[model samples]
Target chain A: MRNLKMTIQYDGGRYKGWQKQKEGESTIQWKIENVLKRMTGEEIQVIGCGRTDAGVHAENYIANFHTNSELSVETMMDYLYEFLPEDIVVKSIKDTTERFHARYNAKGKTYVYRINNGEVRNVFNRKYTYHTSVKLNLDAMREGAKYLVGTHDFQSFTSQKPKTKSTERHIKYININKTGDMIEIEVDGNGFLWNMVRIIVGTLLEVGMGHMKPSDVGRILEEKKRSESGPIAQAKGLCLKEVHY
Target chain B: MRNLKMTIQYDGGRYKGWQKQKEGESTIQWKIENVLKRMTGEEIQVIGCGRTDAGVHAENYIANFHTNSELSVETMMDYLYEFLPEDIVVKSIKDTTERFHARYNAKGKTYVYRINNGEVRNVFNRKYTYHTSVKLNLDAMREGAKYLVGTHDFQSFTSQKPKTKSTERHIKYININKTGDMIEIEVDGNGFLWNMVRIIVGTLLEVGMGHMKPSDVGRILEEKKRSESGPIAQAKGLCLKEVHY
Candidate 1:
């Protein structure tokens, strides 16, 4: 048996998400597994580093799978590239140790959300950015992002109540930058809860739009109530930029 | 009647082309005319600055139409924005003189062609760039581009025989630039013949790939035979960047 580690990139616009489903819906994982099954002539299951919500893109997603196929890594990479859909690409493939686990071995993750704050939308980039003509207060958004950094329980930022043993997670950094008419929010963390990044972006946007105050994030986090946070930002603007091991 | 001048942007991946077709094919002009007809209750003919081939995009295409409607420019802009498809956008709209014509009054035009010279294609920008894995010689391409500048009869560069009174056209400049793994060729000229820009790109790419020498471009231009030039590049990589008046 050989363990294969792969770096993947996908445009998740047409996919349900990264995970396989019982309904057999189209997903990035399902697509790759289907290709692998055909190539290896065996049922193949791929474990991803983490799950991304529907319509979220990824530039450097990591995954690993165990297979008994005798094909070389170069041959497998070439075959996968030839068979996979244009939106999903296997960037690199390599043989790894049997002990390697994609999810458990992941030490950190980074996500970036894009907002097109221009009066006129960019037609070419419409799929990847969320459009908003409303003027955003960059300074206020930056101030609000600071509160979300450091280790804390991000219970209020997720959709459901925490099922894990603890909701405590360390957010290493939060950077807000405006380039031309596009504003990008980049967040790095050890782990993220369901919809946590999107919800945090929503809360920061609310503060930028003057609907909420920067200090409100602290109170919301302390309360640990989902209703206290801002509405969940659209999934289309969010992209899993990197998975660091 | 007021002559309205508008700047348009579109992702032409799905459209047939910029010109309206008699066979009821979907075109950018047809879509805009349909919206104008419904809004003004009159047969509206929109004349664009030039025709773009199928799958070719535009960033600052100019167009003009005479409308009898009493709607303000702001209202028309809003209506167009609401009615047009997500891939098309009206960047700006203003009133122009009666003597103005979209095709005839244009002084110069700028076009840009992008090449993804990377090992892996960028899925997010797949529709907008042409991918080639071959390492390109930028200095060679730039050397070839210099020969195409200034006044020249570029009959060999165009696919169709010149129907105009003169085949002479002046190329103002050609700028070849590389940003990361993307190569951009920006050309500015008084006017372009059909398929002229694509053919020029094809020829330059040949030089970049070391198939042709840089000085061969001058000889190809002097021959004035279309067969002497390289094949026309794909339309997806070409975009009308600006229309200068």
Candidate 2:
């Protein structure tokens, strides 16, 4: 068997999510698999770095799979890109060991959430940005972001939905960059739970808008209860930047 | 009567163009008129700076209308923006003297055309940019652009379907900027005929692709025949930058 690693970038606007679902439901995995099947005439299973919710975008996502097709890596990548829809693009492909799992072997991940804090609607960025007509205090947001750095029990930030693994995860760094009418929050973490980044963004927005104090974030993190966290932000503003091994 | 001069921006992806047509066919003027009528419950007419073809975009188009409604500029703008869809935005509103006209009073107009000279399709910019997988020669394009900047008849560059009274238009300036896979051509002209910008772009592309020599543009311009021009570029790549008076 030949193991392959693929780096992907997708708009994710028309996709149900990254995983395959029941028949009649369109998904990113299903689209990729369908394209691969057309090219190789064989079933190919693709394992992505992680699952992104509907409407979420990705700049560079990693995936791995095993196949025995005779097509070279370059030929397979070019063929797949040509066959796939315009919304999804295969950036690069390479050979990898069979034991490297895109998810489990990932050493770090970076996610960036964009908030359009402007009075005018950015028509050019309407799909990729979440519009917040309400004005925000950028200084207060950066101060709140400082409290979110470092490893901690992030149960309050995660959703109450069940998962197969532990909820505790390590957040290595957090940076809040605010310029003009756009605010981008970059989070580097070992792993993120379901809705963790969205919840963190929601909490920071509350602080920025003066609805809650910066110290409120520490209290919520200590509560270890999902209800104590702020509201979840929209999925459209989130982008999976990179998954590193 | 109160004269109003307004700056407009639109996606232009949904309308039939700038002018009103049959009932089923939507146009930019029709949408603006409907918004104004809904706000004041009075029928009004709006005159635009220029007519853009269907699927073209604009950032700072100008328009004017007369209204007896006693609505403040801020209030009127708020109602229109709130009522209109997200794709259209009214940047600002001003009360102008009756002598001001959006079309005749305009001094110059600037247009920008975006060409995505890349192998991959950018999903976010799919609707706004023209994708070309073929490589272009920048030196040849620049040489051709140099020949296009001058006052001329422009009859050869225009189409027979415009049916305008005159085809004598002057091009004041032309600039080309290319960065990696994106090439933008900015044009400043006294006036433009129907599909004039699209035709210019098409002819320039032919020169850049080595299909025609740079000197061929001079001959094409002097020929004053529509058949002498290159194929018309698609409407998606053109954008009305601004109308200055």
> Quick one: best TM-score, which candidate?
1
What are the DockQ scores of the candidates, in order? 0.82, 0.62
Q: How high is the CA lDDT of each candidate model?
A: 0.93, 0.86
Which pairs clash in model 2? none
lDDT (tens digit, per residue) of candidate 1 on B1-245 = 89999999999999998997675889999999999999899999999999999999999999999989999999999999999999999999999999999999999999999999998778988999999989999999999999999999999888777665467889999999889999999999999988999999999989999999999998999989889888899999999999988
Model number with the top DockQ: 1
| lDDT of model 2, residue B92 | 84
Task: Judging by lDDT against the true structure, name the best candidate.
Answer: 1
Give one digit per residue, the lDDT tens place, for model 2 in A1-245.
Answer: 88889888889888887886688678878888888888777788898898888888999989988888889988987898788898988878899987988988999899999989887777778888988879987788778777778887888898856354577778888888878899898999998988899999999999988998888888888888888888999988999998978
- Superposed Cα RMSD, model 1: 1.5
Write down the worst ten-residue block by lDDT for model 1 chain B: B159-168
In candidate 2, which residue ranges exceed 4 Å CA deviation? A162-164, B161-164
Interface RMSD of each: 0.7, 1.3
Please report how far candidate 2 places residue B216 from its true position, in Å: 1.6
RMSD values, in order shown: 1.5, 1.8
